[model samples]
Target chain A: MILTNIESVPGLRTVEHMGLVSGSTVRSKHVGRDLMAGLKNIFGGELKGYTELLNEAREEAIARMVKQAEALGANAVVNVRFSTSAVAAGAAELYAYGTAVRVE
Target chain B: MADIIVFIVLVACGYFIGGHRERSHYRSIFAREAATLELTLLSGKAIDPAWQVAQAALVTGVCVISVDYFKSVAAGLRNLVGGRVSAYESLIDRARREALLRMKAQAAALGGKVVVINVRLETSSISGMKADGRSGQVASVEVIAYGTALALA
Candidate 1:
């Protein structure tokens, strides 16, 4: 489905507004990954493992959002936005939300 | 004696990993940025038709970065000196760039053109393993890059 963070798609016109569709997931790193990340921290750069972890969570969240949009018969999700919160010390939650619409 | 040894190990490890790794990462980011310069990545909010967007989708990328024991200690020291803790600079820089690149990759993967607009970069600090709440240092950070991927319609 087409997704954009803008209120309206430039060339396309909106035919139907299917309301809000949102998806969220909470995730935490494993001890093994944490230790590896800690080790990587000593020489600061990218924490690939944690990055991947969050990315995975984000993608899953997006998938859920898309499913909701599909259920609403939306061909696109517009004005999509992302938010993150610390669920716990080691746990994080990623949320994706947007307005589902049919555009042509 | 053991304490001194531990300190030396921490510092040495940081030097090798943090210092060397950051330099190499900078080189890689710089190269990739130059190569991708032709691609449009904007921080604007408007949906500009100049993009000739035939199809569009939301694309996102995320990165997490942290400091080693050595840089944390250095940061603590810099706190006392009341100056910039250069230790954390590269951490944020790398996270931001990496997040943006990932977003771009996602956009390109979906048949979207290299142009991605209305990009938003958000950052947050995640608490580390030390949940005791005593050390309050932000041991890690998460950078999120989100944008609209406008491809030729």
Candidate 2:
């Protein structure tokens, strides 16, 4: 599937609006990693653990959003956007949203 | 001698109570499976696609519980004694499964076959600043699942 953050897909045209679609998740990782991350910001380099954690979270949220679009009989999701919020002491929420539409 | 005995007793009591509290917390959140059957039930109709699509907005929360710093040190010491680190493995597995289930429900609602490509996950610290001028941090992580829907021409 062609997944782009751009509102318009290169070749596909949105033929009909299938309405809004989204996927969201709240997650938490190791506290120790967080402390190391703060220290790493000053030192500068890769923080492997947190990086992996965030990457997984993003993938999961987007997958669900796309799934929602598909269920609506939408060929594509356009104007895709992501947002994050603090949900709990050790958790954060990630949300992906887009316009679900039939493309031609 | 009496003061030392009292200190040791107090520490033991604290450990016992803390362990019980942790167990209860896990039982409350980790063991319970969120209702997923609702998605299949709702999808029984070809009704308003928009409303059906909106159902994907359901917020899923996945908590990745790891060993506390003290616990990690203890575990490390236990590892030296040839003990298993089963708790760490269990925590990671549970977090991954929870995220997957949430995505699956969203996908099922969208009538999508699977979540594929360009998947991303993000994590942030939720805690405020600490007295040591360091940020008191709580971790929040998110998983983004996305894919394409195919139509038979």
Compute DockQ for each candidate against the true complex.
0.60, 0.10
Residue A102 of model 1, lDDT score: 97
**Candidate 2 TM-score versus the reference:** 0.41
lDDT of 2 by residue, B1-153 (tens): 999886565445434543454466546434434444332222111223223221122223233333333333344567787767663444444454555555445445555432222233333444332324243442222233332222111
Give the range where candidate 1 chain B is weakest over 10 consecutive residues by summed lDDT.
B129-138
Best lDDT among the predictions, by candidate number: 1
Q: Any runs in candidate 1 off by more than 4 Å, and if so which?
A: B110-113, B124-138
List candidate 2 segments past 4 Å from native: A31-44, B1-134, B138-153
Q: How does each model score on TM-score?
A: 0.89, 0.41
The per-residue C-alpha lDDT of model 2 at residue B153 equals 17
